[model samples]
Target chain A: MRICIMGGCGHFHTALKPDIELAGVCLTGEETPGFSFLINRFGKVPVFPSYEEMLKECMPDLVVIDGLFGHHADMAVCALERGIHVYCEKPMAINEEQYKRLKNAYKASNAQIAAMLTSRYEPCFYTLYKRVRERTIGNIKLINAQKSYIFGERPQFYAHPEQYGNTFMWVGIHSVDLILWLTNSSIVDSHYFPSGKNSFGFEGLDESAVAILKLQNGVLATVTVDFLRDEDADTHGDDRIRVVGDKGILEVKDERLYLFKDGEEQELELSDAPDIFLDFIENLDDKGKRLADDEAAFLSTEAVVNITGV
Target chain B: MRICIMGGCGHFHTALKPDIELAGVCLTGEETPGFSFLINRFGKVPVFPSYEEMLKECMPDLVVIDGLFGHHADMAVCALERGIHVYCEKPMAINEEQYKRLKNAYKASNAQIAAMLTSRYEPCFYTLYKRVRERTIGNIKLINAQKSYIFGERPQFYAHPEQYGNTFMWVGIHSVDLILWLTNSSIVDSHYFPSGKNSFGFEGLDESAVAILKLQNGVLATVTVDFLRDEDADTHGDDRIRVVGDKGILEVKDERLYLFKDGEEQELELSDAPDIFLDFIENLDDKGKRLADDEAAFLSTEAVVNITGV
Candidate 1:
């Protein structure tokens, strides 16, 4: 399958490049120096100066979007309207209106849509999902999802909250997707707390945020996201989820899954899961079960946008 | 000082009995079998039939209240009005009216008052507090406090939400006090998600709760409290507090303190801190600095009550 890459600037496409071959490329006109060289090291794909040129020239089966968050809706809508499947990076869009546009476009097309929600593909999370389904823990009553990322050097877009979306919508949507996917529930109510007090002098950027949500299954969940992790830590991100159920508690911390049941702690062996990019590619033909489909993507983005008011 | 133990039914005072001698006892008429024999093993203190009898007979200088949650305010007010110091168990009052009455009573008297907020006395938390004061994690931006208790056999009071406060106010107040005490900030806005879904067949008892709070210093904090822990776990309670600041993050878990700073993980050595009960006894005469004073107690309780809308 021919895959056209749009906005070859962010690392999302570069990370997925190993799993899928790129047929064409389009710049978002905001690429940094040497961005094309960084993305197309093999120099095998034709680099188009505009997305329209690339779409018409490549006529690719799938379009992977890694553009500016504010421009995602336009890119996604353009691709979906052409009946091309889309694999867009997270924050799917900057606001609800843009998300709605993407959703409407997907409804009108025969093509499938998915977002790069990597948490859904994590081995630890996959293990937790399996155990919860097996009732290792009884009915979940509470969930605490935490995501912390090191604020490494960033591009100019991060300085503008309006363009990049707030911290919760930008980074916290991963946890939102994980919670919904693992619990098989939808959000009933949510409250957000966003702060730019410790943005390290970055104006208009929220450095930290917390979202408390009530799920339809009567489970209370809180998602906390921040960019305050130490850059030299053992991991780039401290991702953890604690699920409290009637019978036991399950936790995924430090890339390991643990089940505290019957007053004893046991580490559950994590099983390997297919890569998200591979799953997306396989779904193109067989249309088998995908971790995050168009509906899941839309619902996660919508819940985050509504909670963070982004 | 002559300390009077009221409602000698629970183990809160019995656990502290080794730290101080009891002069008088007053039961709330809900004592379990051989309660007096268990508390007053030496049979040295006078077992009064009523609180009035104990107060008039013993004329104690300090009153330690472990009564029902519903009667805490009246007992506290009675002690405060007589110029007697009071050390009461947590959820100082079940609701705002009772808390306000206690606040007014404390203001109207010179007597000191403190609550058994044991989280403040934890050694690991003390270490985290000292490091945070030294700017180890820089300015605090976010805090995620968690408390999980094993719901073992309970008294009948827990079955009635009116007699005993709901889960958030009953248990989560410890995290609230810790947040305020460590950060030295007051709550600005708060929201609570309380669920009785997993009460394990107990009616009116909230098995889990989450509170999202915005502090006056622009810090976003969330506190999750639940009674769904495995009873046979290594610890009776799983208490943790993760503080994310501009520079790094500090966490207290498993009775140990960990600082993730400068891209490296370090286990902090916990320093011994004065016990809550001992501190209260020492502060009685000196009127010295106390970790949880009358105002701190009132503020913590007020913040919790307002947030939980109890």
Candidate 2:
């Protein structure tokens, strides 16, 4: 089956392409860029100048859209309208209007679609979601999470509002999706405050934004998404979630889960994301079951839009 | 030294009076009437019918003000004007004007004074503070902290708008103070959102509020303070702070400090809380070196008042 991958010129493709067979990778950039070196190292794969050209030539069975967060909805809609399954990335769009259009397209097409909230596929979150469902922590009441980084210039999204929108919508939405998915809750009220702006000799966008989400069950969560720190410290990237329930507290940070059970603490080993895309390929083959579903990803992105007032 | 302790007929006195040489204690039996066991246990400490009567009679050395968060500032000022020192509970007042008055009175008087942000005195926070300063976590870049509980009965102060002009000032300020002190950074910018009325049905009181603070030198922090979760959970009662720095991320929740270092995670033994009054007592003897100087505490309170827009 021929596969056409959009947004192939980006770093995501640099990681995702090796996991699956790509009949053709499309980019707005002409001249196949650095893929020749990749082809020399791996194997030969065809490259197309644009997504439209690739779609026409390959007639691909699946179209994976790995474009910027703000462009995913439109590209996914285009793919769905053509009756092609789509694997889009998180923060599917800038606002609810885009999400609404995407939802309409999905309904109209009955297309197999998925979103890449790769963090959900992480072992730590997967286990927490399971335990919370099994009532291991007993009636989850609150979820507090953080996804912060000293984003350097390497991720060009921070420098392009047209691509990342804001730190909250770009990287922060991962925690937003993971928390809601883990607790099986939906946001009822939400707000965001942009902290450090672009004046610090930093690149494009607000340096960071703080968001508060009140879930339907009255569980309150505050998530801070930032791009203002220095990335010299590897263990210092703040990616964590803490759920407070009637019985105890369940926290997953970095690569471990701490269960505050009966006044004692216990640690459990969790995945450290050695091969993040491996799960995506497995799920794509399974029609993306047990991974972050399209609806869940959409709601999380919707929360980001609401908070950022985008 | 003589003393006048308010809320004298209640459980607080039961916890505090053992360490206090209370010459007088004031009680207002307005709700369910307070217990008289204090008079039975420590007969030497007179039980006054009211604050006025106690003030007219005892003229004590210190006013141990344990009133609600809203009223403590006003009562502390009144005590200070009469040349009495004040040792009050968290959130000395509910607005900047009142906080200014409290600060002014402390300055005008020749008496020793302090506000009880007792969580700062908690062993876990002390350990975390020392360790961070000692470079256990290296130079900090981000902090996420919280203190919340299941909303109890509408606080007496909530009913009196003259006192608690804002809910964020009443409850959220402590979490604000904690994050500021833990990171040891000054504010650059902040934004907050209130979560409607208290879920426990406190009139005019916000159920919760969340804020994002940008610290000088580019570190960012977020804090959530609420009274909207079950208090039984281990993560539900005390304050929690996570500081991500250049070397490591240190998390202090209640009485435990969880440290992430060199690809391994472990809990550290924290310190013990002494009589918070001892700090003021030492400062009184030296006229310097207080745990939290009035100016510093006032600055934190001002940051909170400004963020909540009270």
Candidate 3:
């Protein structure tokens, strides 16, 4: 099967680096960092001049869509209409209208799709998921997650809400996706609080934001995201989640899982993580059982769009 | 100064274990833990028959009120009306009506008052506050706190909402007061979520709860509280707070302050912390310069009542 990458604007394309073979590559006509990453890793693969031209001529069996945030939905729709599988970056669409169009196309297509919600595929989180599935922490009642990112260099597209979407979709979507995936619950109630007070000179960015969501499965969850970490911090992102169950507690911090149970705190060993790109490709054979499958992508994006309304 | 303690139910009476003269003591017609604590620590102080008698006959200059959750407000009011300074366990009031009554009595009296918000007086938190006040972390942008406690032994009053109040007022108020004290910001918007599904056989208790508040200073803050911590865990309470500013981050986890700044994570030395009860006593002469003064207690309790409505 031929695999093509559209818009080297996010790490989604890197999923192709480990195992899959790339048919073609498309850049957003700028030297975005993601393109540099592709160049550094794959070293000058085939390039497509424009996204539309590639969709018309180089339509491969699958298209990994990244690039500017607003353009992702239309690109996915274009690929899906041709019965092509689409694996896109976070926030499948910037608004409900775009999401609706993509949804209609996805329904009619004889293809599989997914978002690059790779957190579920990380070794630490994967292990945590496995333990929770094993009832190590029984009956998740409350969950709190935090994602802190350094305000590193950004592409020019981020200055426009139309191009980059809002910060909730860009940064906060990760936690929302993780929580929804773990709980497997529908949002019954929610409150969205965003402040663009310290926007770090970006017009559409909220440097600090938080949301509280009550799910149908008797879970109260919270997400706090910020882009105010010092740029020179150790890692680009600091992620944490604490799940409190009636029986035990599980926490993940800095890519490590800490379990508090049996009256002792233990750092559990990580499970082997599968390649994200391979996971998506394998989902074609095992449709509903895929990790972070189509439903998760759509639901998480829809939730973010509803929360941010951008 | 003559100091008396009323209603031995919480740890507030323990403050008298050090450097203070206990003029008298009163218990709420039961062998509550506070009375046992006074007996074990001070070998029994001057015992009064009832709270009213303590106010009228003993008439100590200051009173430390800690008893049934709902009874704290009226006890404080009684003491404040007699011009007796008060250092009470949180929250000062459970409902707005009770808070209003306490406020009136406090306004009419010349006595000083404070809550046993000993967290701000602990070495770890006191150092963080001092450094934040010194602008070590720059402008505060967002904050999140977690308080997890065991569903251990409870007094008889906890079985009723009218006597115990809700979990937010009982447990979540600690973090609310801490956030408000640190940011010095009034809440402009807020949302509270509470669930009593697994209340550990208590009627009014919300085993899991969360609240999000947007402060007037453009800071977004959140509080998550749970009575689901495993009963056999290391400590009865596991508390944490993360303060994020534009320039840096300050976090306190399990009584240790972790600072993330200058591209490094450092644990700073803790400063000497003063006794909370003695702080209020000294504030009688120092006036508004107390650590957590009258406004802090009333504002924190008022916020809790508004959020929980119990």
All candidates in order of DockQ, best leading: 1, 3, 2
lDDT digits (tens) for residues A8-72 of candidate 3: 66766546555566767788864466566665575556777887777677768889898789899
Overall lDDT per candidate, in order of appearance? 0.82, 0.68, 0.84
TM-score: the better of candidates 1 and 2:
1
Docking class of 3: medium
Candidate 1 local lDDT, A15-124, one digit each (tens): 34554567788877766556766666746778888887788888898898888777777998999888888888887888888978888898899898888888878899
| Tens-digit lDDT track of model 2 for B1-310 | 5677875311244234555567787754422134455455756678777776787788987877766555677778888888887776556666778888988887898876666666667788878888888998787767787876655444365655565556566666666777777667788777676665544445666666677777786777778776645444445466678787667778886568988765567899877755566676557666457656555556666777788777
Per-residue lDDT over A161-206 for candidate 2, one digit per residue giving the tens place of the 0 to 100 score: 7765777777788888877787677887776666545724546677
Question: How far off is each candidate at the interface, as Cα RMSD in Å?
Answer: 1.1, 4.7, 0.8
| Candidate with maximal lDDT | 3
Clashing pairs in 3: none
lDDT tens string, model 3, B68-145? Answer: 888998999889888888889898888889999999998999887888887888898899999899999998999999
Report the alpha-carbon TM-score of model 3 versus the true structure. 0.95
Q: Which stretches of candidate 1 lie over 4 Å from their true place?
A: A9-11, A14-21, A29-38, A285-288, B9-11, B14-21, B29-38, B42-44
Clashes of each: 4, 1, 0
Q: How much is B287 displaced in model 2, in angstroms?
A: 4.5
